[model samples]
Target chain A: MTDAELLASCHTVFPGHKARTPAQMFAAMGAWCEEHGVAHDVYGSGALLQQFEQKIAALLGFESAVFCISGTMAQVTALRLACDDRASRLVALHPTSHILVHEKSNYQLLGHFDALQAGDRHRPWSVDDLAAIPDRLGAVAMEVPMREIGGQNPSWAELEAIKAHCRQRGAHLHMDGARLWEAAAGFKRTPRDVAAGFDSAYVSLYKGIGGLGGALLAGNGPFVARAAEWFRRQGGNVIHRSPYVVAAAMQFDQRLAAMPGYFARTEWLYGELRAHPLIKPNPAAPQANMLHLHLPVSRERALGIRNHLAAQHGIWLFSRASHAALEGTSVVEIYVGDNLLDMPDGAVREALTLFSSALAA
Target chain B: MTDAELLASCHTVFPGHKARTPAQMFAAMGAWCEEHGVAHDVYGSGALLQQFEQKIAALLGFESAVFCISGTMAQVTALRLACDDRASRLVALHPTSHILVHEKSNYQLLGHFDALQAGDRHRPWSVDDLAAIPDRLGAVAMEVPMREIGGQNPSWAELEAIKAHCRQRGAHLHMDGARLWEAAAGFKRTPRDVAAGFDSAYVSLYKGIGGLGGALLAGNGPFVARAAEWFRRQGGNVIHRSPYVVAAAMQFDQRLAAMPGYFARTEWLYGELRAHPLIKPNPAAPQANMLHLHLPVSRERALGIRNHLAAQHGIWLFSRASHAALEGTSVVEIYVGDNLLDMPDGAVREALTLFSSALAA
Candidate 1:
């Protein structure tokens, strides 16, 4: 058999033999520009990107939007702006929020924000968790379908209550909606429905949309006007964002439409896998397009089996299968993407059988 | 004359361009990639941008370097790193330094850097000027060839003394070398010679190099290592920077070679304009590729005459002919670029004759 034919039997994050390299992405953008006759957006001056921003803002039900290069910059700038008209610089976030854990508390370090941890790491915050904080808050930030913990999200009523509390406290509610697209599917609502409560929301352009790298902060006119200056000051204001804009706009429409299907597939996998004694899916339910698959092995053994499945069976799975806090068990987060749709109907069960057989061996 | 020919005959920032629109820039990058079989830089992953970075580091003689989306981010990150290893948060800068004046004190506001203004507005900082600051300083920032007043630089010996003074006071020396390429020609030295004494330096990619947008900060390995983390924290770290990388690399070689010529042309133009009674040149002697041309006209009148010349004589100057601190005299900063070189030999003399005669009337 040919090497290419042999590889076709295995599924990967990329399609068979077509890795999405930098040159490929750039070439795609160039092709996109020519096909659409897309005019270039010069140094944040083009109409195409502004239209992209408007489409996103409208989808999310925000009055205004400004694009960003990173979610860290977007969320940080949002929180800083929320605090601008307030006396308190104190902001509230979940303990496992990406900014608190990954970015070295840069909200306080670079953005001059004082962060207060609000929720438990194992679950999404409820109204009570936010109400327990004693002092006045400048802003309250919540990750929609928090990625670190099985992509769990609060119920609609619980979320609405938290938003109400923040408003009553004269604080802005900012959504760190990095995966808002998937989260909306879990809620069985349009993205606009999910974003209705927040004073400001930051949505990522890459994670769900698969753009180069960018995010957009959505808010009212005055809020975004204040935030744009900070965006410029932070050096996130690029001269030519057309490459990012074109790529993001092209994928945004396609992937956003497919999010519901990805979410359903994730739910189906979790349901099927939960019946096995050796296989455990966290939260006992799929909240979004992500699930934590717990294998009855150590983190190292789990990683080995994960790699083995890809190498031997050609059925690619998680790269980050890790040790669960529980003894003798490991976990991996499966974030469903468009690639998942390409797999055969029995792909998950078949993959699970191999995962279980390897651990047993 | 036809409108296109008439407009083309008058020089612009871009010779062939009515203006340098972003679409044209993007199309150029697309063409470059197709021509060179260039690869993409996915989240700073590709080697091509690093090759470009190495070229800059070697030219400036720094051990390590990192590219940033904006000079504002580069400088803020540099000063933050410089102060991290020390206790002092206070930084010394000229009163008119970009971070202070144009950015609206963002160094203090966004970066939390305390400002300690040093030196005179009219001239480059001397050893005496730096030695006069009493307090312990974390870092001292000087823009080589200060762009606002008139592109001016300290003599090599004077710069050395200022560097030594900063060293003796246990402060890091930071060079805001946004226009370092042109500044080197005025000093009659290499870029490495100019960057030798500073602990860290930043150079712009788009300003003189004609790239879309970006800047690079050069420093020692450890310093750059720390700054890189902040670069990510600040959201200046970009994925798919191939467009910027390709464009910047394409222009770097051509422009760096042409720096001396642009500087000389600026000096020549300044020398010719000084003889007129109503026309005046700031600093009396041209220092770099820029000078402030002062005329005995009000700001409003100067702007009207400036626009008239662009329309009538097919020679363009500036719209920022401002009311000088002195009454009745207006000043315009003339920043010489590649476009000026494209003008006819008699163009400057013709432009000057037109300018002086208008003021006289």
Candidate 2:
């Protein structure tokens, strides 16, 4: 079956899904375009894009914002702009930041930026880690809810301290705020307030909004203007960004308003999952709308159980199971989204019971 | 009125417009999605993208292709792969290459690739230019129908010599094939024949195809595969590219077939314009689907005439008037497209009369 058909066929309860069904996503985008009476962006900027950028910039309390094709471009381009003409193009971040692990070392390979790894693997970068960096850095990059490690984040005060240190040291601070929507909800602060700690921030449009993929790099006007140039050089300046921009604008409000609810449900669901004998919640309590669920089952058994759940009950769960698979433990990453919200009460308990029985098979 | 309404009202000829109406584009995309029975790409690869990539790779006679958000990313990423493990990250190209003039020096700034000028300002790079570089290099980038100099390109033999020189010197050859579709018809070469000269080539989707924006970096399997990883890190690995990919697929065949027709139309249009007392073709002969129409008029009056054409006769023409505007010479760049072909017979003569009258204003 086609991917769209497959996704539509399964009744999924996974939070990591950043998009709805393809048909639904496009339909809503078409509707949004009609209602706004706006044209698609020509080359990264137009009425639809301008409005989208303004809304995001205002939400994050930045002077300006530039839309890009992906968060990788946004972050790299932002850091590149930050390092412009600096004697040192050094940056420090948690070792697991997307650039370090997922980007194929582009910061060093393509961007020629040196990265200093800081902080422990299991936790967010602390103020002590920031203080430990001896050199003057071009920028300090941080990700909220550090997805690699169970969506845990530093307390707001801690994050603020890190921000202050970067400022005091003449280093530009950037936020890899791909999931800042959740961070804001978790910290109970406005997005602007959460983002105020950084000189610039890269917030994702696709993840929180659950729309077509794109990102916004926000900073001061000159910085954004410069980043816009880099955006083009780097190919992030796309033509006809209507689907990404308009649909993102449409979903922004609904998703932003729903973040607190998602956060609360995350806590509730984690609480529910913890009672299971074979299940354990990393972080125990979610800092945001996603966490990791470790189960005493093999990866093969977890895959069998997930497939069984989808086939028998029409319910799709996490994408895959990991975490010490050789030791017969299955780790599933859970993202709290509308999928989880759509589940009925005690649905998780029933699904876990089935999962428990399938582990033996 | 909105930009869409304004564009709808205009009945003029211009270059650089590839998108039809936003509604039409999305409708075509939606239709393609339905026919293909697939969804948009999630993160750079999926059913829709694979089909899109395969079609371009086959058309260009390359072993593989990776879709990117724009030509800049495709070129830079392609070169990084080309320059892999090389001591020299230096490239030689036309002095007016897009990355040099438009990218704010991103190849040097972000990509760390030093560039050396290798061609005359007014012509394509020749074997002499390659010999003049006087050093080992990473790659040699050449634009087909170099847009800045009124869409002029060297004969196939000249290009072959340059390609041979690069190969002889152990340097990679790259093509900024943004207008390769136009160039193929102009040179009476197959797309594959044109692309075969380069180790890696970046062809644009939105230009000739008249589709939503995206680009393809085409090369051998491993080069494109490595470029795909770089693509993700560079932020070109976006989610939900169905609208761009499918709409482009819809446009590709028809547009590719129409290039020769467009080239002939460009000659006809340029011939007609040359008969005007005040108008002159920059190259004196059409090289591709586009050319520069230089006029002995001020930029303001040229703009006024264009606006008059749109306001009075509903014709949209040219993006801007430049080339010594202060010296009262307005150069209007023209591209032959379906929009130009849709005009009535002898329409150019009639439009010139109106343009002359408007210039008098």
Candidate 3:
């Protein structure tokens, strides 16, 4: 099939927001390959390493940045580096972090790490929540805008209190910033301001920026430098990775800069959804470009609506599987990004209308 | 700069050969992406695990296949799976295997496997060479057409003997077939035939097939199934790596079938190189598209010749660095593949003419 056909199919499947198309991704990569020169470092910034990292660091207000192949790798590697061979292999984290579900226990199996479940996977943790953990942990990893819990984020006050708790315990604070860009808008703070609380942050260029693939781990010079070495050691370094590198840079420069607009659009969309009788946003107020949509229909009915929206309506909506996995929930996350920003409010309203109609049928 | 400009510059850098122009690489990738799907798989084949694995297995004559983002990951993971709590953690390999130099001792670190050096880094290992080692080994990994050693491959007589040696010791055999396509031509064998003696094999789709990026690991069903689980545990499984998956399949069907022609051309070129007084081909018989050119010039002078060939002659050639790292004489490997096959014999002859002229200058 042509790219147009593939994208059309994806639109039917994912609706509103979709992954970056290969053309856009390749264009992003081509730019990086032209400017960089490298003779020594295997995973150095000279390739996609520099452009994606530079753009994200500047966007996130980081001192330096390193890129890895996955959000999982970035998070686990950053946490392992932060622990620095300490006595505690225990990491305090929300029950629903990617490390627990998606990462297949590399932290324990490979890095000898265990999670001290400190907060609700779906709720933001407060100082009391952190202090509630009886174990002395080496580090605290908090996901900004917890994904498993419907992208809910705690208030800035709660964030600071958690930071203070980490300070009191002398535990390192790390941010699972996979969707941090969306959270940055929710907090009404710059990416850098949100990043200030953590010893290291991982920002995914693909999810937020719509690049083809890749993620960045950012922190102070020593931490980032050490991470770069580890990246090589993990074989994250490949010959001529400039293509993926450039794709991230392009997404950052072209798409990431428009994030605030994405926030505005998401706000408008969220407000409309919450006002509807059948549709409700979890936490009511979204912390980022994503929120949970709760349907009164059974899980099967919700999936039917989701399929109708894709197959006939040419719209994509995600619904939670009725089954339980890690954190155990049936609420699906609705994400809005730069792609959906251009979509008309009517289309958003119509999608909800279709969902309601499907439930009625 | 645009991708077109990047391709143009790359063409100017390595003019006149059958080598892939950046245009060809991107064009081939475009075809692959459109035909397949281009989601970046975290595990290498990323999202579409089954079909990708099937295609890879078919390409290399394996019962099953798995994908990895790098050869290092493939080798390390394969070794780890092969070890399976065995007391011996030793992997017998040529001194110049990628695991030794390119990888940061990941076998030792991740796989916990020690290297039992079998031959000189610049030479292929014979059955006796491997037998010379007295210690028991868990597995033996061989690079068919070892890349670092000028893609030199052992003779079939020696290969059977090495296989016998590994079997007698009950050691698993693994082939690092990263550039096995070139070696296939050198050996005048199909990929499966060249891989026949090994317990498992890895073949890179991106190197010769010219996809965006990916690698394939294949073996018996049980081993591949275990590797698949490890791939997910390692966070190699991306949500949607269909584009690379589909593209690799198309390239495997199209380019891999044409490898024999590549071999035929390489044979012709080997004869031409051997006739030249200024250059001597390693192994002299030419087992693959790769050959070491022994220039009488100093290491510095050889680099100058390479640069002159690239800049002035638009002919890309590589030169080995001095034994500063390993205490050996300098040698450079010239790789001929899709790019070199198209160049006229006169052009290659002319490029060497320029090489000889540069040496005089």
Candidate 4:
């Protein structure tokens, strides 16, 4: 059978979350809107989106918030405004930051910001790294639970020191908090607690929330007002944003409440896998709901084992494996969410054990 | 009662189209996706959006097409690409173009292009208007049936001459074809015929097709590939675009076929209104499925009459009136869509006659 057919037939998938079909998502959004008597937005203004934005702002301890079509637009607009306010076009980012890796250098190309690499790719930036930046920066962006090196975050004290350093340098501290929800759970702090000192923070609505897709950028009132203008300039201001707004509104609370559970599950799963000789997880422990598992096997062999598990064991694991930092090994990221939580106890561990044996063989 | 309560209670709305509640839009999208067995798109890829883009590209007689979240992004990206290709930052726009009037100067602030005014704001630009621009432009953007000027398009010969002028000046001719369907009906031409010779064109899927908001940019292969990159850079590349693609696909052909009828009704209605005193259309003729009615009444009086018609006559006409160029006159735009065409014969003319008499009083 084809890989897609095999995946479709799997009884359980140990990835980020249970994937909902598009039709199911739409139906759920419709039901929620009917129950709530939701109103449609016009060019990003309406009771639904405004109320949601306010709720998010309150949750994140901000004076205001604006919803955008994507996290890319929200963060870029935030950085652009920060840079414009400081009259310096320079910003500092980690080498593995989403702006540096995923966005095709739009922060430099479209936003016209000169970017300085602030830290190494394999670890989260510390206060010492922030002090080493030579230029007078307009802004410094930090991604909580940096995803590239497998969901590792700096200590709370480090984050605070970085914030203080930005204040001393007169640079805005912007949080690329796309996974801030997960990181907050790991820190045993509320989202507002984690977000308190940043000038601006952008959080993805769909990543952990399991909504359709959108983002929220939160800051003080004037900063958010500027973000609204940049939102329009970026074409994030569509005539009707009701679908995304409603989907996010419906799922946000429940999913956010479940983050701690997901994080706990990640810790358990990481512990179970770490006992196996063939598996080595980045960061050595779980800091969030996601991590990378490095296996001493070629990517092709890892894929074959994953496919074998899906076909014979009815368990879906990693989609693809990439080359790891070390020689002759491949790494796959496993993000624990509702999918892992919903699975019966020991099922995931057993499947991983089998896969590990196959890798060793 | 509030204006919204009154509007919600009305059976007819004669502006652009009947407003769909957010729930209804979602339900319709769900139904369409179910019938089509549509697959979801990821980051603007997948068969659903790909097939729709190819269909639009073929219809517009272009080598390829890219879908964007808004017409603003499509147009801006297209212009940015054209300017980059020519190694020049200068482009030309009409005084009342959406890029200038609506987008808050993003092309200048974000795209960093120098924009020169190409024509007057009160009318469609002609070939002489194109010739009058003194700069060696990177691109020239023209709106088909310019909406700000009451949906008036230049003659075919003038359009052809403008194309020739752009060619001689070595500038890319871009069409802001938001209402190209309506303009094609007025020109007695196919959409492909109307779009011929333009280096790139942007069309609004939601404007005429009655979809949830999205847009398409059509051009040759390399230009379109560049547009996709720009789409991602601008954050117009969202994760799940299936709802918009399915909605637009479901309605495109039917609405496109209905444009000629809508245009014909506009012509007949224009004739009936012009016969009455105190009412004058901008072009003195209906060029497409929309026109602006210049009434010899103050804006307040026009709104009062519109409310009277809505409350007493049960007919929804213009929502608001703007101050016309002439003293003591106001202009309201009437766009003929499915809502207008669904009305009984002469009903619109009779209501408009009452409005004219009210103005005369």
Candidate 5:
């Protein structure tokens, strides 16, 4: 069976949030709306969306927030607004930032801004990296708990230092906080506390909140108001966003409250996987509810093992394994969420043992 | 009460499609998915979205189609792709086109293309207008049944001549067919027939179909494949589009079939209003399911009459009135859809008489 088929047949997945069928998701949203006396939003405005945006703004300690259709829309617009009036339209970011690796250089292509790589790949950029930049920058974008590099986050003090350095350089600080919920748990701080220093921050509703899909870009009132205009320019302003807003609002509190538990589970899972000879956990420890496991197996073999785990044990470990920097090794990322919390430790331990045995063979 | 509160309290509305509450929309979508055994689409790929795209492509006689989150996204992407690889990145469009009036110049600001105004703002551009442009053009964007001009469309022969002119000039012809469904009914032709000769066309699902929100862009296979990449660039690709896809799909056939009825109703309504001295209908008659009513009243007076009609009769005529070129006059656009079909003609006539008496007073 194909990987998708295998994953579909599995009863449990040891990764991010549990998957919901469209029917279940819509049913839940319908029930929530009915219970809460929800009204539809028109052209991205109404009580429902406005209330949700306000709540998110309060949570992130920003004066206002705008809900976007996607994180790509939110982040690109935030960076564009940050850089709009500056003499130099250059934004600084890590080599592995989502804007660099995943977004097809939309920040440059569509937003008309040049991006300067601040640090090498495989790790988060530091305060020194920001200070070392020779050219003037309109903004500095930092991703908390960088996903491509095993969800590693900088220390709270380091983050504060980075903020201070950006201010000193007269560059706006923007957070690509798609996984800010996880990063907040890692920092042992509230989301508002962790989001305090950045001039603007974006959070994904779907990643940790398990919404169908949406994002929130939060900042000072005027900045966010400017982002709203950018939002219209990007066609992010749709007539009805109530479905996404309702879904995100319904799942937000419960999922956010579970983040610390998920983080603890990631720590335990990292410890368990570290002892295996074939498995090397990046970062040597867990910083959030995510880790990268570098396995000394061919990509085909890794797929086979993944399928075997699903078919025989009904445990989904990872979906895709990417080429690691090391020769003859593949890396798979695991994001701990409700799936890991719901599973007993013994089941995960047994699955790991079986996976290791299969790899050894 | 606020306009929105007035809209919400009304039992019947006479313009555009019937409105559904958030709870009703989600519940209907959920029930449809359950009945059809629907699976969620992941990041703009899946059988459901693909099938819908195929159906639209077939309907439009195009090789392929891509669903977008909004009409603005679809049109901008289409125009950008049409202009790419051309020596001249100058696009020709009517001065009052959505891209010019509503999109905040996204075509120029984000798409990086210069727009040359082709025709006067009060009417649809004809073949002569296309031939009059002095510069080498990358594309000519025509809005069928131009909404800003009371749903006016060029003749089929005029459209064909425009297409030929574009071909001779090596410029792509794009149709901003947001109301193409109604345009088809007005032309007494199939959508495929109306969509012919255009290199790319965009249609809105939420406008007449009563779907929550979405759009479709149709073109040749390669062009649409390129549009999918642009869709990603614009952050239009979301994790799950099943909600929108399903809603559009469920209503597609029913609403497409009802266009003729809506158009007929619009013709009748236009005749009823054209006889009134206090009201002048743009275009002098209806070409499609939309008409603009020019009333000899101030904006506040028009709005007060609208609110009074809603409060006393539960009949919604129009939401907002824009100042007309003539002094002490405002223009209100009325889109005939399911709501009008459901309302009795006597009630509508009575409301109009009351409105006329109110204006005379």
Candidate 6:
């Protein structure tokens, strides 16, 4: 197949119509390289990396930023750095946090750190729940919009209380701000405000930012500076990460500058899904661009429908095996991005209709 | 400036030039994707990843392989895996290994694994050096064709002795085989034969093979499978590493096949350099494609000559800050690649003449 064909295939496979054009990603990077008068050493420390880091720190109102290869590595490094002195290597967090479910004990294996399970997996972590945890905690990991249960977020008041509690206990509060932009939109707050209380925050460029690959860890001067060294040591350094960085900056430039508008689009998408009898969103109201949808179909059936929508109708959505409920209902994540925002609600509704028709067939 | 100018600027700064043209890397990957016809889900247990593991295992003469983002990560992960059952998380290694100098002690902070410094820093490890380590070692790390001091490799007999020593002591043998390809050429052996004694080996796609960015950790079936799980936990899984996989296959197809011919050119280059009076290679013998040429001049003067040659004559080479007894004498590493091999001996000699003229000027 040609490059165009490969690019189209990427679009088809990506769920929620959240894919960025490869051409656009590359073109922007190439342009950036020309402008900078330096090679886009995205992997190494260079102009592109510095600009991107500063842009992200400015966007999030952090003191500094360090780019890393992955959000997982970034979080692990940040948590390890946060464990700067006292006895406990224990990180307190909601049970459904990325550290617990996704990291697969890397904190334990590589960070030599343990997790203190603080919140219920089903609900967002509240101030009261955090307060109940014992003192002497090394760090508290908070996912801005909890991913496991469909991007639900607690109130700002509750977050402030939790932050104050951590400060009182001498605990470093870390924000797993993977989708902080989405949370900012939902909360009607700035990204900086949401990330304000945390000692460190990790934001992913690929998810809502629509880049090919990359993440950033932000914190105070010493913490971020050391994190940069750790990044090089971790082999997170790449030769031409400029492509990824440029892609991120391009998408983020367009999207992040207009994130306030994303809340309205998210609401529109969520409304249409809630009206459907077969579709069930976890929270009924989404706090971000992503939401988990439950369908009364088996995992295989859901995937079949997803394939049908992509291959037959050229509409992309997602289906997952693990998120499927035991009662024969499958849960799949649907993300809203630049592509989906332009496509009419009718296109998505029609895709779902096709999905149902395929299951019936 | 143009892309070529930017690339030239980068060429002037960093050391290695083993990378393949990005277009060639991408084209090779495109072919692999077509040949495999499998969706490369870089995240979890995907088909392409499964095939990647198996193919790498077959190539490295192991039962399985785990894919990671870079060689640095692959080495650190392998060491951590080896120490899983050990009472003391101590990894024994030569002082010149990548982990000690390049990685910034990630093994200490992340893996909680300490490097028990053994072996001479200037030369390859001996059997006596391996036996002298005082710790209850979890694993003994050895780099085939150690890159730091020059791509100098141990004789096959020394390797066999080191393997026997590790086996006798009931310690795991880990190979930091980032330059295993070069080592194999030097030893007149296949990659598999060279890396056979180690419990695990980490190989880089970008260094010698000229892929975009990726590494493979090959080992026994159980260990590799577990490593794959750790890979996921560490968030090394990007949304799509298929581009990298494609680049890797492309490198394997083009470079791996062309290695035999490349080695002949490298040998010829090594012979030519050794004939120089003022210039001297550390061992005065070329083991691999790369050799360090000690120039009888200050690093400042060496760099001045190097800049003059590159900016004026388009010749590229590397110099070290400190590497030998001739105190201000700089070490220039000559790497044989497609570009350098294409340069006529007359041009090569002229470049050296230009360097000498610059020093005189």
TM-scores for all predictions: 0.88, 0.93, 0.86, 0.97, 0.97, 0.87
TM-score for chain B in model 3: 0.85
Q: Once model 3 is optimally superposed onto the true structure by TM-score, how far is the C-alpha of residue A323 displaced, in angstroms? A: 3.8
Roughly what TM-score does model 4 have, to 2 decimal places?
0.97
**Per-residue lDDT tens digits of candidate 3, residues A163-187?**
8778788888889988887888788
Candidate 1 lDDT tens digits, B126-242: 989888888888899999989877787778899889888888888999999988987998888999999998999999987778876788999998898788888888877666666
**Per-residue error (Å), model 2, residue A300:** 3.5
Q: Please write out the lDDT profile of model 6 over residues B1-361, one tens digit for every residue.
A: 4334533654333234444333333334445555656454536456666776688788889988877877777777777778876666889978888888877777876654778889788888889898988678988889888877778877789889889889888788998888788778777889989877789998887767776678888999888777767776666767766556655664575677666656677777666665466777755577877777777887777866765556766665553445456676777676666756665777666666665555555
| Predicted candidate 5 versus true structure: per-residue lDDT over A1-361, tens digit per residue | 6666788898778887788888888888888899998988989889989988999999999999998999888888888878885667889989889888988768767856789998768777778888888898999899998899888887788988998888888898999999999999988899988888899999987878988888989999999998888888888888888878888999888999999999889888877886577888876778888888888987777887898789888878898889876676799988898888899888888888888998898
Candidate 2, RMSD to the unseen true structure? 2.7
Better of 2 and 4 by DockQ: 4
* lDDT over C-alpha atoms for residue A223 of model 3: 84
Candidate achieving higher TM-score, 2 or 4: 4
Candidate 2 Cα misplacement greater than 4 A, ranges: A1-8, A16-19, A83-88, A134-138, A168-170, B1-6, B12-19, B85-87, B356-361
lDDT digits (tens) for residues B159-272 of candidate 2: 888888888898989999999999999998898998886888999888788877888889999898887777777777787777677767776888899999889888888767
What C-alpha lDDT do the candidate models reach, one value each? 0.78, 0.78, 0.68, 0.85, 0.86, 0.72
Q: Rank the candidates by lDDT, best first.
A: 5, 4, 2, 1, 6, 3
Highest-DockQ candidate:
5
Ranking by TM-score: 5, 4, 2, 1, 6, 3
- Chain B TM-score, all predictions listed: 0.93, 0.93, 0.85, 0.96, 0.97, 0.89
Model 1 clashing residue pairs (backbone): A23-B40, A43-A239, B43-B239
Candidate 6 clash pair list: A43-A238, A110-B110, B29-B246
The candidate scoring highest on TM-score is 5
Tens digits of lDDT, candidate 4, A1-361: 7665687789979887777666677767777777887768877878889999999999999999989899889888888889989999988999998888888878777856888888887888989998987888999999998988889999889988888889989999999888999999988899999998899999988888887788899999999998888889878878888778887899889999999999898888877886687788887878889888888988888898889889888988887689876677899988889999988878877887787788888
Interface RMSD of each: 2.7, 1.9, 4.4, 1.4, 1.1, 4.7
